[model samples]
Target: MSAAARAVVDTAALRHNLLSVREAAPGSRVMAVIKANAYGHGLVEVARALADADAFAVARLDEAVALRDAGLAHRIVLLEGVLRSEELSRAAALRLEPVIHCPEQVSALEQASLDNPLRAWLKIDTGMHRLGFPPGEAVGVARRLMASGALAKPPVCMTHLACADEPEETVTRSQLAAFAGAVADLPGDRSAANSAAILAYPESHMDWVRPGIMLYGVSPFEGRCGADLGLRPVMSLSSPLIAVKDVPAGGRVGYGGTWTADRATRIGIAAIGYGDGYPRCLGSTDTPVLLGGRKAQLVGRVSMDMIAIDLTDAGDAAVGDEVTLWGADLPVEILASRAGTIGYELLCGVTQRVAVSYV
Candidate 1:
């Protein structure tokens, strides 16, 4: 019995979610964002699954390189672009489009004389201060890049929406307005929507749309689950119950005895914990885990490699019964809210120690 815990990647669900994105932005092309190992769903696996995507976007140069090495012919974009000459040269070789977010990136592209000119994206900092040039300077930057003759075509323009998830905020509209003004006369395509924008803001969908967490079946909006948006979950984390023990009333359970047994309780020890990418913060609340197709409350502190679940209510639960941390039946978003974190962290935090099976 080597089974401890496993992350099961549902390829069919992934495909379904991609279709959802396409449906949301039927008039726009989709650049499926697959950075951070496809939000920890396995980079190469996700790329192969989303072969129908118009393009793929990654935060780092190496991720794009990995896709190229895998012989995937999909258009891969380096979201952060390159910082040095070597990276620029290699990006050109790999046919990866780098998003020029800063003046230094443009300079690097200009100075790096490659045998072939590269296709690039001009990023305008609408409101996200983390990257890109000021929206006011976007047109000038595009003009400079054009004059520099470092591109195979006029660069595609893009801007990241900082508050697209918060529909109440006016930032999304302002960013869209700024992006529109910035690229008003630019001779290239435009992209502005992320997962949140794809669902909430139709006007932001320009020539292309970039979707990240939605492709993994996680909601980008607050106070909502993926199911609310017609998306299918792709990652289901589960482990087999190793032991079932009966605790007498007033008995303490797990580390520090934080969770006291108010009544006679049946606890099932599952082989999953923070070490396996289960959020350590989850135990602070009565988050439920699915066992025997029923809800079992998680109790006590989450150990490095184990967790205790109050399975008294789940009739017929026994050793070898599978416990689902989050999946098809147990939404990760609910677990994330209980843990005081987002679903993205929970998915990306799955450590290498846990076995992953892609189906």
Candidate 2:
């Protein structure tokens, strides 16, 4: 039989999460951030499932193009904007909004055809040093986009929140202040809130609310998890327990003997591992899993194709019993924490070998 390790996409749950996001930011437009292949939930499938979504946000040009080719008529916002001048015409034709963040992008947009001047969002660097014009120069960029005869309409002003997830930080408030000050005179609607802002800071929700992780039912706050927020998990990773063995006390297991049995134990081998997007950094022990509705503990390092779960209580477990590596049974955040990472990395890093099964 084919390997049983799989990442299951929950379509109904995805729709439910989108509704929750809308509920969180009532009346405001919602741009579902489906980047990173919809947080590894399967982009096309999530896109299809959330067809009623107000708009979709992606990072690269190809992702936007793919949506267009898929006959998705909703607005697709390119977060990185146009990387090259050639993208302008295509973006215009596809009706994708490019989030112009730099002078090179502006020059490319100016050089592109005017007939289908693309809709654009101007990103201002409030505090996040990653991208966008400095706060002082944002107003000028907005004006330039409007003045360009090639442009069809005024640009929307936007800024990314540097620390919206951390409510205690003054950064989010500072960012909001900067955004408000810079776009004071700019003529189009503005957006600044990410998932955290949409949830924790209502004042940040302006013309548009961009929710990425929250749409996937993940908690934006660090040290917290989706379950803590009443959000349902949309991805459940599972595999079968294919082997069972009895190990004596003091027996060593897995690579480099990272884990050792302290007493008589039953080890159930689950066909999931780092190669399947499970965290390699998760210690040989202390990692958690669910087997047949019971908690199981990892007793060895995650291998390329399997994880050994301590199943002393699972005397009934057999070859085909389902083992949950994450989701449903254990929150992805919990797994990510034990793995020393975040849900984004764990989701997006699922390797190719594991067959993805959508539920």
User: Per-residue lDDT for 346 in model 2?
Assistant: 86
Model 1 per-residue lDDT tens digits across residues 1-359: 56599999999999999999989999999999999999999999999999999999999998988898898998899998988888888998889999999888878777778877999999999998998999889878888898888899999999999999985758888889988998899887999999999999999999999999999999998888999899999999999999999999999989889999999999999999988988877877878999888988999999999999998889989899899999989889998898888999889999998888899
The numbered model that scores best in TM-score is 1
Model 2, 1-359: lDDT tens digits are 55568878888778888888788888689899999888887778889989978899999999988888888899899999876656777788889998989998887766676457677889999999998999899878877777776577788889999888885869888889988999898788889989889889899999899988877778888788876877778888889988888889999888988788999888889888777778777754377788877887887788888888888866678887889888866888887877777888888888777777766
- What lDDT is reached at residue 349 by model 1? 91
Worst 10 residues of 2 by lDDT: 109-118
| Candidate 1 vs. true structure, TM-score | 0.98
Per-residue lDDT of 262 in model 1: 94
Model 2 C-alpha lDDT versus the unseen true structure: 0.83
- TM-score versus the correct structure, for each prediction: 0.98, 0.96
